[model samples]
Target: MKKILLTGATGYIGSHTALEFIEKGYEIVIVDNLYNSDISVLKNIEKITGVLPKFYEIDLKDKQNLEKVFKENKFDTVVHFAGLKAVGESCEKPFLYYKNNIIGSLNLFELMLKYSVKNIIFSSSATVYDSTAGKAPFFENNITGKTTNPYGTTKLVIENILRNLSNHKGLNVVNLRYFNPIGAHKSGFLGENPNNIPNNLLPYVMKVAIGELEVLKVFGGDYDTEDGTCKRDYIHVMDLADAHFKAFKFLQNSSKKIYEEINIGTGFATSVLEIIKMTNEVTGENLPYKITDRRAGDVDIVYCNADKAKKLFDWQAKLSVKEAVEDQYKFVINQNNKNK
Candidate 1:
């Protein structure tokens, strides 16, 4: 069995992807610092997969401790997901974002070069695309490098670095620019568990539904959409996990050193109000919400033209937004029960 190194493996998407890799019969190791995620997720993954993956509580920023892990174990590939990801927070502290996301990624890349582990699946974001450059749906071929916040800027910079570094004879890189990811695993054993107040829409909505938060603060409600709010292509977390699996298969069959970027999304735009309505439908209660000013660095409408992912990987989202809402609600209720 090929062993994989998963940075930030305890994170929301990383944890789900770890389960997927295990189910597909791959041996995996997890590395996370528990910055934004909890340590208990490791147990949850073991509960679902019956295999407690070897985990390292090391940060990517700590090069010495990180190097020790690489020296001791051989990794066939790496799925890089460690970083500070809040847009507003990134705007507040650009330097911190650059240091944590870019510098840490650079350290990891250098280590990869040293160890001769060339294959990688980078966790990129749609924010790297300039929404004002074109229409609603962004394609892989669309020009990037225009981002509104430091968090996205970090992703853009790392992507450039990866592209340039992949020019070497053996390095193979696949950068997956993800759209909004929501929902939880079907078992309710794993879900989006942010350490602090949630930043993403689905998590925030879940908090409101469970009475942890009084009202869901809708970011903007006067955008150019049908509901006068921002619209995004929110893909389910499990579907996002499946894309990583497909990417691994695609990378393994490559004959030459190649660097490819693909967008992973559902290719359908759902507005802010639509998400709230969906949440209400799942909970059977009209959750209280208040429309607020548009947050800085937020776009009006940004979804994906996911044809390239389908053409390349034979993968597209299988879960519906309604199902995502239901799964998210279930996870939130489970967590609430645990706290009580």
Candidate 2:
């Protein structure tokens, strides 16, 4: 069995990917600091896959504890997902974002090199694209390094770092530039559980549907789209997990040193109003929302050309946005029942 190291494995996407790996019969070692996630997700994973992953509660920023994990386990690949991800928080505290995302990544990469783990799949964002270039269908070769926020800048810088490492140190890197990921595992055992107010779309919508929040604030409504609302390539989290697994397999079979950036998203774009409509249809609850002024740094449309992922890894999103909404609603209802 291939031994994989999943950073932030207790978090939303990480936990789901852990299930995918376990189901594929891979041994996974998880390392998370429990900052944005809870430790009980391990139980959820066990419930889903009937396998408990070896876990370490070590922050990637702590080089000492992180290196200890590397010393003990010989990993075949590393799927990196540990970082501060809030865009507004990143802007308010750029130092925190840089120190946590960039420094922590540096420590992890150094340890990977020391342990001779040459294969890695990095969790990147489509925000690395130059939104000023205007609109969706962003390809891998599109202009980058024109990010409008600190969160995106960190991802761009990290991609550059990975590119340099791949060129000089013979490291094989696959940068998965994800569009908006917004669903739950189909089992309803795992899903995004943000501690605070969600910064993303679907989570916020779920909150309103569950009566956690009063109303959803639609950010922009004057964009150059059919619905006048900004459109995004919202993909299911499970599909994103499959993309990671396929990318890792791609690296495992490659004979040459490689640094490839691939877009992982559904080629279709959905507007905010469309999401609200879907949520209403799924939960049978009329979601309350308000159209507001466009937030700063907001783009008109942000989707991707996922043909590269299909051509390279034979991966495309199989689940639709409607299906994602249904699964996410199921997860919320399951969690509510559990808490009650």
Candidate 3:
């Protein structure tokens, strides 16, 4: 069986991708710091999959621990998903974001070179595109240098680093630029369990529906869109997880020509009001939300052109928005009951 080292294995995306990889019969050894996560998730993953990956609570920033993990595990591929992802928070503390996202990655890449693990799949973001340039359905080579936040800067920088690494005779990669990742596993056992306030729309709406938070604040309703709210390409987190598997397969015994950056998201775009309405429909709760001032760095519209991913990996997002919202609503109910 092929083995993979997964950094940030307890994260919103990494946790689900771990399930995807395990389901495909890959051996997984995970490293996570649990700085912004709960360890209870490993139990949930075990409950759902009946297989627990070897877990290491090691921060990627600690070069010593990363070196130890590399020395300890013999893996064929490394999926790097450990990074500070909150856009607003990245702005407030660019140093923290750079330290965790950039420097931590540099350390991991150096170790990958040391250990001779040349295959990697990076979790990139669509925020790297300029919201002002061409329309939605963003292609790979469009206005990437115009990101409005430090989070996007980190992703872009990592992509550049991975490119440089690919120059070596062994290292080859696919930088998967993710669109919006929302929803929970169908089992209601594992999902994007954000530790403090969530930075995305789906979780915020779910909180309002569950009464965790009283109101969903819709930021900036004056945009040029159908509903005057921000438009985004929201993909199901499961789809995102599955796409990683496809990309992994694409990387399996492939030509060097396959080393490229790809976008992974649904081509369809949804607005904030549509998402809120979906949440209400899924939860049977008419959530109370009001439009407020636009948060700085918030894009008016952004989506991805995932045609290349489909062509490259024969993978397309399969879950509908309704299905994702339903799963998320169910998971929130299960979570609330567990807390109670």
Best by TM-score: 2
- Pairs that clash in candidate 1: none
Error of 3 at 231 (Å): 1.1
lDDT string for model 2 (1-340, tens) is: 7799999989888888999999999999999999999988999999999998899999999999999999999999999999889999999999999999999999999999989999999999998999889556899999998888899999999999999999989889999999999889888989999776788889888889999889999998899899999899999999999999999989988888889999999988999999999998887778999999999988878889999899987999999999999999999989989999
The estimated TM-scores of all candidates read 0.98, 0.98, 0.97
Each prediction's RMSD to truth? 1.0, 0.9, 1.1
Model 1 misplaced regions, further than 4 Å: none
Candidate 2 runs further than 4 Å off: none
TM-score for predicted model 2 compared with the true structure? 0.98
Better of 2 and 3 by TM-score: 2
Order the candidates by TM-score, highest first — what do you get?
Answer: 2, 1, 3
Each candidate: what lDDT?
0.91, 0.92, 0.88
User: Mind giving the per-residue lDDT tens digits that candidate 3 earns over 159-275?
Assistant: 888888787545888999998999889999888788878988888888889887888899999998999999889899999999999988889868664468999989889999999
lDDT, candidate 1, 224-287, per-residue tens: 8898888899999999999999999999887767798999999989988999999888888999
Identify the leading candidate in terms of lDDT.
Answer: 2
Model 3 reaches what TM-score against the true structure?
A: 0.97
